[model samples]
Target chain A: MMAVARAKSRKADEANNPSSQVLRFGADKPLILEAGVKLAPFQIAYETYGELNADKSNAVLICHALTGDQYVASTNPVTGKPGWWEVLIGPGKIIDTNRFFVISPNVIGSCLGSTGPASTNPATGKPYGLDLPIITIRDMVRAQAMLVDHFGIDQLFCVIGGSMGGMQVLEWTSTYPDRVFSALPMATGTRHSAQNIAFYEAGRQAVMADPNWRGGKYIEAGVRPEKGLAVARMIAHITYLSEVALHRKFGRNLQDRQKLTFSFDADFQIESYLRHQGMTFVDRFDANSYLYLSRAMDYFDMAADHDGQLAAAFKNTKTRFCVVSFTSDWHFPTEESRALVHALNASGAPVSFVEIETDRGHDAFLLDEPELFSAIGGFVASAARAKGLA
Target chain B: MSVNSNPRIDLQVVADLIPDNAKVLDVGCSDGELLELLRNQKNIDGRGVEISQRGVNECVARGLSVIQGDADTDLVYYPDNSFDYALLSQTLQATRNPRAVLEHLLRIGEHAIVSFPNFGHWSVRTSLFFNGRMPVTKDLPYSWYDTPNIHFCTIRDFVVLCDEVGAKVEKAVAINANGQKMGFSMPWWFWNFFGQQAVFLLRR
Candidate 1:
């Protein structure tokens, strides 16, 4: 089955004219990690919405959340759906594609044409599976920096993302503060809490419990652990929402008919919603990639480099930061964002924080919230004007 | 020269009160216009603390050295006696803990310039007494529920609070709504009769 998928992908690549392509940078290969492992020939899949200006000052990097692809404002060829962030990025939208060069890349450890667990290892010509080197958020930012350097962008007008994408945005500022002029890290924390890591652990356990998984070699064994992957996605989806949002969106409501079937089938609207979420997620994502990405998130502790003082991590940062969080996102609560703000304040860094009132949970950053749009739009516009882009 | 270039308060009053070449901190320094005036006109070495990111960006765009920080929570980062004067023009009333903050300003600077809306002015007083509701005057635009000015203070109330904190007043100037200076004798009535704002220079 693995060989068949590869053959199908090759045939599709040859038969179907390329509508889009991922641009490469650096030495055309992945660099070795500090963990004493080499990840060679890794590629980044990216999509661009607008033309780069002559001076390249209009370049803006847009980081995508977990499970999100590089398609920012274009239609995704896989699902035949509109871009995930179409509402925020368009000709005249808040992000304003007409005025900015937007780049969204499928992050490393993701399955969308990027090197991940599912990608074949050149050494053995088989999927890396559990053998893929554990990549960190900083590693992702380093790859992105290479991409930005390839584009000849000396200074990014702004780096913007939310959730895991927001984590990358923070990393870009800390690791390459001179390159990033402004940063908008929305609905993200400096590090994943123990509770968050526990959730990821539970999801991984759910996937491994399925017999078809066969210890992460299901693809080589010619079997797909769809049920296990779906269940894992279902459990993870529950964490991405707030209790208020769940109550408002589904409130013990029945799925089709008013009466409960009293059976094992999905009886409540939330249960049906979870089932749909799980089934759709399994279709596009690789299960092993999910494990790798979640582990990467669990290991993400930005302050560990600064001697356990989060404020010290930003002492030398000169990038203007706009930290935003939703009121009802309990997964990465407003308190978490406040902690980041407190650190920035202690470091004497220029920072602005706005906890917008919303019941959209952690995913509010992706939705069509007028308040979020206005805050980001206003911040970016001001930052651009300061950089003389306007 | 232009109507838009005029300061929100009496420019001459601020200039007269702020000493020449004194290190000054301006909270809520919108657009850095006041800071620009202090730098070019008064020749004061001015630093600003503005809450709005847009405001801070504008300040930086104008080549002014300003930090983006909230006066309510970010002021404690500064060391004691960091500046000769801390100016809170039309911003003290908006703070969550105005009394404690005024004490902090006095502790952080040799002197403090505290200015706010005269809530006990005739119009606001009448509005609440006669109309039986929160006043929505020019100085206070939002309704009570949404207003950022959580602690409304009057000129007389401020003077009493300053006395209680052992802060001596160097100069107290009240201005009419038209920005004209009012005489000291019954200035509240004169302010009620004509003035709209007040500025106080205090010494600890």
Candidate 2:
């Protein structure tokens, strides 16, 4: 759909211009892994909008979710649609590209423009595949720190994201407390709940069950494993929507049929929607990349990192926090977000929390929810004033 | 930090009770003027919770960290001793559960500063005694049907509640219609009738 946008970039030289392209880093500054390994010559695909002011404090890092790439306010190259959060981070929008510099980078494990399992291995002269070091949220953040340093920015005006993106935001705040002026983590939890992990495992299993997967070496085997990946996507998509949203959108209505055919084909509108979502997702996302990112989320445990004391993770943190949760988001419910707020409070870190009443569920952060927009707008504006951007 | 030279007398009294540089939470902090005052002037660490989104927006606009939440429900989320002081100004009477919120404030902070409109004031009494209608005054301006104040109480009633909840009243001040502090030595009945508002410093 957005083929035109991608086609133009190939003809244009991608030397060192800071518009939109893949920039390889971490060679001289290799990322030391939590697994006691080193990932060198790695690359990060990122896109930047607005202008970094002279003081360089106007930079706002926008982290994407598990499947999202670095298309914050623009059209996604894969789907040709406006970026997932254009409602929140665009010109004159809440994040306000007109006022602040925005940077969105594809996470390390994802398949977009970033180095992932699909990237060629410099050592072996083959696809890295499963050889790509398992990345944690912190690893993604450390890479972002490198990107921010590339711009000569010492501190960010704000680090904002939702879902897994929110997890990265938290990691950024805890890891580089002095660098972030304000943080907004929306519809996310500090750690993946057992139930959430169970769901992710289900998706991972669906990917693994495919004979075409070839045990994570599908890229080198020249196989797509579309079936298992589609099943995974279908299962994962259900968690992102609330029962209310599902009922409102579909409500058992047949998919372009007046009556059920009584076959294995989709009879309900929700079923057809999920199938469509699955098919479209397989066209863009990578199967092994999905496995690696999902596992990364399951492995995330901020409290466990701080010796089981969540407050210790935020000891002496100066970054102001704004945590948001939606009412019907059972996946990462309001209670989960409150835990982060409670930890921040115990550490005496300044934090604000809003449990927005919405039936939109986990995906509410991606949608055009007015409360989220206003809250983020007010928060960024305030942080900007405090950062001397006023 | 140029402190506001003139603050609302009730808020000024509330501000005086907070120690400099102490962490504080202001429940139902409408637009966060008191939080702004304490944060800028005394260098106190303060956050706030306001039920209305509009109030939260305004507070955030002024660079005050305020969350949109209800004190009655959200107070229980904070850990014990999270703040040095918990300030509730002109909000106690309007709470859905005054006792529970008060208990949380006292438990969550080393001390609490609670200020509310005195329903037993002489004007409200005379209006009820003579006019025989739900008394409306500058303090309790809302009529019975539309007021957010669900659990209205007098100064004496709040003092009774403190004892019931095992919280000691460290200091209590009553302000009149003109915002002048009344003598503490006065009898409860006299203060209840004459005072327009009451401020209390409580500790467990």
Candidate 3:
């Protein structure tokens, strides 16, 4: 019944937004999800750049962080803005679309065209909403693996990502160690820190607090829950940046006011900036999808899959690894990257670590940091040499 | 030691001591010149830890797999028996606890190759005895205020440190101020008195 409702919801969503590029898969060989539910008749929306070599060894998978979509090096269909990672993934950029085929997909539970809470249930014929089973990072990777399998590629030359995307990179490497030639997990940790979980909880509460949410049935109830989603994005955005970055970007400067009028109407420049950020975000993103994706991030724990020994996740893994972190990123600091390096060393896996000197915080990987690019480019070139690619 | 005829003369000896295709960790590997040589000449799998950011950048630019890390704190990250040899060329003197560093090196690798400028060379003694000031020889050229060699020791002192740390000296060689390797038949005391630097291969 819920599946039928989901199918109906998907049809309604399709009618509302007719340009969702998707790849459909039958339920014959469902990607076994962590929740023990075999989802079939599912679809994954993805965008690819460059050409896959005859051997398919030059394929590179670029996973995305929270709120990032598959439009990696192209214009976003929803926002009309350039791709999120344009700096890192382009024709001659660090990831080098000219040299390697890059694939970016909207993860399993996201607002971007991929199957998520907004996606219809094949059984219930309505949006899955609360009916959709909560997903984990491993589940997200499993879906991506299915997408990779569809392309008939035996092994990827490299898999790289930052933040939540980095979590997927690690999950993919651990779950299918032999399939990934090299792995780069930047600005991420093996497990969600307690503080991060608290932040996510705050975001979730903010969404649930709005009456327009209508118990997550707002779409069918003719409401958008914009206020709740905006508040959630506001709180979540603060975590993606550092105090140093915020101070530098907005400081205490007033917004369009000569002096302190002292009205709560965004009296500070930072307040006006965050409000603008929150408002623009709701225009393109869905509320329920945000909740589901946030939960997935919270559920991620790599060591849990290996019986509490993180090193065991990469036991004798032949895949080379390069872990990266920024100095001022308090959310995912260099210490987390060192822990990852320590685990790789314990597993006897060959690994390289670079703690880039940056004050841009956790969002540094998505920015123009020359050191990050050089480190990544150098690692990729060396790995290519090892893989016998020119 | 800037006064030495060639700072790399001791590195040449270290490169020769290492076998082909061996797994080596070069701690405090500034600029990774030795690692690059080992990779090309001996086909060894080399990794490096350098303290300075500039050194790491140079190593990376040269296609060396090096991480920016201090030897005093980062050695604990490497697993025991992970490398066939651990090299600390001209770096042991700069460490805060030389004995602990040596012990960690022995535990992490099958053998530890260490080289340091010997403070007991005759020139250093002459400066102390006559000038009543710290040596300004080719090997120990820096003024006391600017010197980074905080735990300077001689060949005899290092041998005693090895003994106390339960590390057996597999081999030893001393290079004179002219950068010539001293004869193996020469007593360690003779090398201590005349040689400007000493290199030792130690094992637990």
Better of 1 and 3 by TM-score: 3
Q: Considering only chain A, what is the TM-score of each predicted structure?
A: 0.93, 0.94, 0.94
TM-score of chain A of 1: 0.93
Chain B TM-score for all candidates, comma-separated: 0.90, 0.93, 0.95
Q: Estimate TM-scores for all models.
A: 0.80, 0.86, 0.94
True contacts kept of each: 0.03, 0.46, 0.32
Local distance difference test values of all predictions, in order: 0.77, 0.83, 0.84
lDDT by residue for model 1 (B1-204), tens: 111112377556776888789888787787778887888887776667787766765665555546557788878866678689988887888788887788878977899987766776666777788889888754456788998778877777788899899999988888765667788776455554344567889879
- Per residue, candidate 1 scores C-alpha lDDT tens digits across A281-358 of 876777888898888788888788788988877877878888888878877887788788777756655666667778
Candidate 3 residues lying further than 4 Å off, grouped into runs, are A1-21, B1-6, B136-147
Q: Can you rank all candidates by TM-score, best first? A: 3, 2, 1
Candidate 2, residues A245-279, lDDT tens digits: the string is 89998897988889989999998888888899998
Residue B19 in model 2: lDDT: 79
Candidate 3 lDDT at B40 equals: 88
What TM value does model 2 have?
A: 0.86
Which stretch of 10 consecutive residues in model 3 chain A shows the poorest summed lDDT? A11-20
